[model samples]
Target: MASLLPFQDLNCFPNPHTAISNATDPINVGPTPSSRTCFPTLVPKLEPLDDLFEPQEQEQALGNIISTPNPENASANACAGIPQGVPMEDHVYSEFNRISQMFWAAFPDNVQQSGDDNVSNSDSRAIVPVPKENTQVSSVVVATRKRSSQRVKELVRVGDIRIEDERHHRAVVRRTRMVYDSLRILTPMEEKKSSDDSAKRKRPRGDTRAAAMLRYRGMWLNRDKRIVGAIPGIHVGDLFLYRMELLVVGLHCQTQAGIDYLPASMSPNKEPIATSVIVSGGYEDDIDDGDVIIYTGHGGQDAKHSKQVAHQKLEGGNLALERSMQYGVEVRVIRGIKHEGSASSSNKVYVYDGLYRIAACWFELGKSGFGVYKYKLLRIDGQEKLGSAILKHARLLRVDPIFSDSTSCFSLDISLNKENTPVRLFNDIDADDGPLHFEYLTRTSFPHFVFHQSGSATGCECVESCTDGCFCALKNGNEFPYNRNGILLRGKPVVFECGPFCRCPPHCQNRVTQKGMKVRLEVFRSRETATGWGVRSLDVIHAGAFICEYTGVVLTTGQAQILTMNGDSMVYPNRFPDRWAEWGDLSQIYPNYMRPSYPSIPPLDFALDVSTMRNVACYIRRSAAPNVFVQFVLYDHNNLMFPHLMLFAMETIPPLRELSLDYGVADDCTGKLLICN
Candidate 1:
């Protein structure tokens, strides 16, 4: 028979088998109980325990065991009346002890219960009633308790069980994972600085004078109407008045002593000692005091000296330099006044030297090895002296207008023949044809040539023969290219015109090219010679007479090379054959411009392409014995950088004679002529 006492009371027995054997002995029944008392007293009160098998259950179960006088005896008496053949509850008691050991091991400290007062120091225990009929049920209960105990041990080992609230524990774990996942490579401070810098750069700055000047720095007069230059109805004096302040605004030229000479005014105490001397050592050999001096806004580089002398280019300040390049454009020259006595009495001021005229201009390398623009200038006589002399000794002569109509294709002030010969276009091609497709560039597109105002020398009011005393005639060595019959000289390379600044009447003899076309011409098909079109004279043209000009887009050498390689047929080489040798060595005395070896391609050379958007000159065909020849002329002398192409009659021609030009033959590296059939 087994004890009917609760499982906790089994702790008092050394062995459940011993107790069962003693209960069967009649001597062990000293305090034998009646049937009702035995059952009720041996069975302890059954109270429901919490889900966790709370410490309170262990305390009450232990109290029942301690209240008994001899727990082992009571257990023996209690089981004395039980049925025989019931296996002793040793396994159940062993399992109960094992579960208790596991619980204590899982929670070595104190177990935390749910609700307000969570902590408890007492050990937890589980109690289950044994069924007298079945040992299998008890074995099942023991297995279930073992599994629950193992689960508790695993929970504690992995640290899933927390002493704090379960919700708070979970929240802390989630926060840790989030922080690890959201980590960034860059620190917070670095990211904020980068964002702030990006925002600052995106903000716009106001329109200021410095900003405006920088904006309009590289634009030309034709592109920007606001620019002051040789524009129609505008004078050179007006530019000086509007832009005098900007002349020295960005001047970078300075002396070795840190003294700048570009300013219109300077402090008397810091006056430069070498005011009259040229900064460049070799400049004095090529230039004289009266020889037009071009003032540069920036200093020139030593490496650029050869290029400047060869090209006759001078670099200077932007506004002043461009304005000074205009034909007959006059600019006042000033020098700092040196004070020998007390500095108080002597004030810094610019002493006006005289006015000078722009003769020629081009781009050249500067001291810093960067590309810079340069200008050539010629001194102009005072207006008062020249103006009075012209009025007294000059005589007005009958002169033809320089242009027939402003709306004509060849827009100039020249007069055309009144023969009424209708001009014709043969094999007419549209501008959008294959390989010739290009945008039409108007006169305004030629910004390098166009000027906002005329700056021609107005002081020269010569009405008749321009004498050597006349500054305008003196500029050309007192020899005009054209005669009274409008016949040009045979060997002239360029022709200068009397600009708007000249005091001479519109009929001045110096203004020949500006007088426009004078012969009747026609464009006709020439399929026989493989030439698309050709031009012929409608009327008889004598030798040395001015013909139409070959006009086209000006392109750099690199651009021209690209066009030629791409099979462009309208490209024409614009080279100065007579000056070619001089170009190789500009300084005859020094010979510094000559390089040790020639480059594969000249970087500064330019060309003209008339394949698309061409003028009537495109009709001219090539021939061995051509009647016309091409000549480079500075028709609009205001822009020295651009040279106009003019056609001259090489020989006398009858009416309807086909006008032709001898396009120079191409030669190979061996100097052998390579004729293209």
Candidate 2:
């Protein structure tokens, strides 16, 4: 019988097999007892992606194995049978899986022994999966299939001229997001330094002022080109949390100035024209009437932005607004309003309200009894609904749920009052036919086999909330993983959140994902093609904001397989694509800079059974270009073997937009049918 015990060397392992050394060559070992062809203890190195290599070069790279002589060996036979045009990584993983299956099949006694142990300990309680020794190797081998099949389709369709404008806009938007993500990291560091010296100055700097100035000095902006109409890649409903973000994306140029304009030397008519303006209700005399905005031009305002300090003049930005109105040029209008959910009163959310034309300009007496330049800006026609208006409406709906059609809602609070915010269930397409009968689950339910031995717990000892240098924060590279605004600073392989063992209160900043449902969400019928039921936020969800956790009954791979064979659908969390690289592409621009780390976890041989009981996340469908992404988080449980599957918004999702995830190939392309793009 083949030995299943651990061994230091491949040769020591009781298996007569050949070891594959590299991608092209296969080393042969003498045949032994069973007909099964066992592989080396170590897995073969994955091949480079074809996109990184030219076609001719890629063919040349694979030529040695395809054209080389094949001898009477299992490895040689497998290498020779590799079909042309197939992805190199796909073949490697396929062979690796075959070897693993054969190896396990050869040891029937060990398999039965492990199966019996799991069966004897099985219970209905939620518990961690048993930690396996070779899980890391299997996880790494499976993790390479990160991009969705839709991404492959997109790559093929990129050359089409019909979508050239769209392609260009997507590239610009991607780069802009990258710049913004990078700035999020840099701004906090700069702010910390500024805060240390804040006492020395009479007027302390705003949140991102110092950082914006530094980025300007470094010229770390998307582009210097200024344009008049709608800026490429920026959508009307796009939201920003900082003024620095607007600067990085080239939507605005000034670090402190509200009005951004092109000088007369750059304008076609040799006259200064306003390009964009921010209306933060800074002037008491300003009126915001949805489509029409009475904007207050820069100057004559005190440092506090409350009242005018001097008489207004028609020059600089004031003159630019007048010229724009006279020349019939459009101006981008952004609205800055206080984030209702933020604890800090200074925190504001900026919304791009689309192109607007200056209709009239005049000097008006402000509320402070002083003259101030005022400009009436009218929103352009045929644009999407205003994002700010949607947010205001959503706020009202939350206060009085009855304001909406109560009959359309199948269930008002699907969480059964478990979550702090109520999750509504609505079905307008059909006659209030709610989802099939399923018990509501707020958290993951693990099997009873998870070993729970009493051990000394390790955690932070913060009195109120965790701070930098705490145990939990230290585990995350000695820095708080979340910003003061509760946004994740950067995506990592794994996020360590404060658990019950920690002395900090439940509201600790370190426990971000643990806080259930920060945004109001609802289950709605999707009108989009091929989409059935979908989840959407009732309020604006910022990028990196924790939406909800994938909660359901967790089962071992063995249990899941039996259930699958018995016609039960299962969700393999490990098989979800790793698209965290989309968060930022700074490495493409700066060679030394590293891309945002994708959440990497070991291949968890477990599946979530959501048929009987599941959360709202189950309703979220899959998409190639998804607005949400799965993140591996550990907080309530101590098992690295099984982390909670948490979903976070990959980008700013406008209210009522369907939430989708990039569900890469199910089983990581291990010959299983593709579940989603």
Candidate 3:
């Protein structure tokens, strides 16, 4: 009988009697080899869910049907009964790719090395292929012994481990593309092998050839020079892509492209003024200010034009007696053309680089004290007026104001134009004491091509001489009172009323024994606008006295080096010039671009309006709302801090102008705000 408790092992003892054995017979070793199997009466099983059962009666006989010695064999048995559609290669590749991904994630930029001989083995490691077809990781690849890319041409198939390569075959793709482009380079017949390729011959030259070869930039240009085709979003290690866009193709004409959409050269992907603005005031908007340049119909009859007009205009036409730089005469394109064996006149220009050229048209000061002058202008190039230039078909117009009041007593620019115009655009602070050599580029004002360079044999007798769109200088010794074009015309930059009357710096010319005098100012600039930031936020300045200065230091190499040297080797006093001291390193370096005030001295703190100062800063002090007026005494014969700053004792007012540093024409002013900020 057994108690109702867990059973114990049965007691089995070795045989009580011991037996001896002779050498002839074998005997069992020290302990008996066969062990005893113990048996005990077991208790009755209970159902696991029974309420009456204790924890010991939990397990029941029907709870298990498991077979021993079968962990993996179960899968084999299961598969034997059912079907698994997954391809063996796909399964292996999937597993390997997952492992590779996890590996890289674990060691992003770190390399693993075992010992002292540490070297990278990542390149040699096999890459597992990623699926290409949308077939749910069932992509099939045929692996041959042929290896010709950045991929391994092998496969491994073990129980659960597998590996393959996934490379795009860039070299092969590039080679095929080169072959296609080469076909286009050959003449029409040279490319013929079979009649199948003949249909492509009718395709336009650069336009159709690109798409067939999968060259996107050229294709985009063919479709339209604006859109770029879709590309992989990642930009890592794409130097070859740049080569394809730039070197292989000659499509740099676009204003902007790539990530930032900046004009290829001039724009560096930053916000800048797009269009210029100009405001000409008249009561009921009737006055045109008689501007030398005006759009076909000005654009800024609204915003930004009113404040400037408010300052200069009153109910009557007369401006304030304290009007700053008002009533000036002309604009000078300093590099005037020399008439071929005739009296000098006729304001004509031509185009080569597609940019029109104008000569030095001077401004007479009439003893108006040099301070500051502001101007409004319109830039227009009409479709009917432009002939064959790139701008011929573009609707181009801009407006802006100009301010030029500098210290140099005078400035002259005579660089010639690509299209033999009378002048290029401008020369700098050098005096216009020397003679100029000018030439003609635009067709004569009349329809005849018997241009000034060759001159018309019939003069005014010619049917269309000086009639269509040009100004005629009496070249080839034609006649007196040379003919001219007017800037007020409906075309691209036409000149008006040019003669010997427009002299610059307006010395004592007020007595006026006037000979064809039309007053204006000539502009030379390296910037589009001299960006200004000061005590006040921007104010709507009337044309009275809006002023600012060039903040660049123009230094020669020697002088720059001296300034840049360590404190131990420096020569000049650290006490900076008043205008530029606060600006510090932001100040312009010399030889960079600005008129006068070079390294022999600090970059002038302020860039005066050329129209007003007319080289007055040679003696004036720097001012935001500057009160005092200055004059140019003379040159620094011995290069030193100017001998004496000459303050002008004058009770006169004059209008003047200056140039901006950007490539914008110096006189466009609508975009020209006095950035009082």
Candidate 4:
């Protein structure tokens, strides 16, 4: 036997492979028994994936090997292989497998071990075959059959193994085969970073105002509900009250600047739907922001019934609805609650959904004022069920006496058109069905209540006037926010976000901007220099398109710094992130109200004008050209855009020399030219 141990003792330990100066390199033990003692060497190598042996077992006896099925007698070869200390002509292959034992542990499933063997051709065997699992392959490396030997090189990720070094390719294979009967690749191990260490990294401190204000460095709301632009240099998640109307809550928008923007870059198709709402129960209010028992249609306007109840509850007690006369529908209400501080203290919340087996619990809600909730229409198989649901608990005021106390409601607010939902309304739900489905939304600011009465079918089309500031949205059989201009109550604007006559334009993006309105924007700045040259061009021209807009902002190279999450401070009035640059050409001007910083980088008011009536021609970019005469027009009128004077295009861009306007605006045409071409 190859020496029981490498040293003098009987214990099996490695000889401390001296050749492994760099752990990445494979150790090569020569084909000499005296030099390679089988004293159970430390395992570092793994089996090559493409070996002659079966993926999980040694098909033959201890002394034998496995091979691919031959063209003839496939079944014969399955049992014909030799075994047991049987030294065959393929000794080189046997020796190769012997070397593989030193490094097999790296493979997870290569655990089949061989017992002592004798030099025999055939012997008894114990084998269990297991299907091979594919290696956790790298995205870059694809497997191919031609490179059979190369599989061994991929088996090792030892500290010393240099992936690109081809010298150990053969030895790596020999050692791998000797160790494992099975193998598989693992996913790349990710090095985790501790939160403390991340926090310790140095960063460019946030801005000066960030330290002073503590709250203004980002978008926030004030007490009055208006928006206060961010204060320049604060941390994320900090909440601060802005100019009264709006509050600013820090989000990770700046921190996650480079995050994945597309969420559903991959998905499948959608399914169709039918009617959504199953009108369960409803009641009308007797009082109308007043104290009078009027006719409640649910009770069919009983004067004697109404007067008896109004007199009974005059002292304040309870309004209970437990019988079928109160509501005529079935539902599964998972939650319910009673109205607090009601005129009647004992008003019990009756939930009818659970009384009848219909659908799952989607939502249940009720506030002191208007009770609200939502429901998702579940599609089982391909059928859409209109299960009428009712509020287990709600407290809505209907002016006072009649139906004010028992009103429960909800709305559907979604971008339904984009979702391709089918909605339909029906007269009798049990009758022949149509294609329309009902979708509802809620605009809570309006404070209106919505009732899902037993016979109310919705129209097929979903609501469309949904944009910024609009309260309502519709989706597949469900509703969203309760908007001001949404659902109708007694035929009036819910809360009147925009005055009736001031309705927003159909294509407008905000609730504020409407048709025929000119919003004025103003800025406060101190005057600097009186004037600057307009343009110097190589050729003169008559009036046509004079590049009318002004280029007001210019950045510098040292100032053209790119900001990263680290080493950079945040900006305040946080607008115009796209306009930031180190050094470049001219950029356009935004209003002072739109400026992010308190004191903005100076605006160029200087322009060329000959008449000296203090005529201000907008600043155009600067340049040096021979024939391009840049002229400034003078006007006696106060308006800067109209009633102008002189004209010129003074800047000339030579052949290959690229050009751009350095600073301001162009000359205006006053209709009468002061100088002829």
Can you give the TM-score per candidate against the true fold? 0.31, 0.66, 0.14, 0.12
Question: What digit string (tens of lDDT, one per residue) describes model 3 on residues 549-582?
Answer: 1212233346545544432111112212232211
Q: List clash counts for every candidate, in order.
A: 25, 2, 85, 94
Candidate 1 lDDT by residue in tens digits, 428-485 = 3422222123333222124343444324534466766454457665555455555555
Write down the lDDT of every candidate, Cα atoms only: 0.33, 0.58, 0.20, 0.18
C-alpha-based local distance difference test score of model 1: 0.33
Q: Which stretches of candidate 4 lie over 4 Å from their true place?
A: 1-677
Give the Cα RMSD of candidate 2.
28.9
Better of 2 and 3 by lDDT: 2
TM-score of 3: 0.14
* Winning model by TM-score: 2
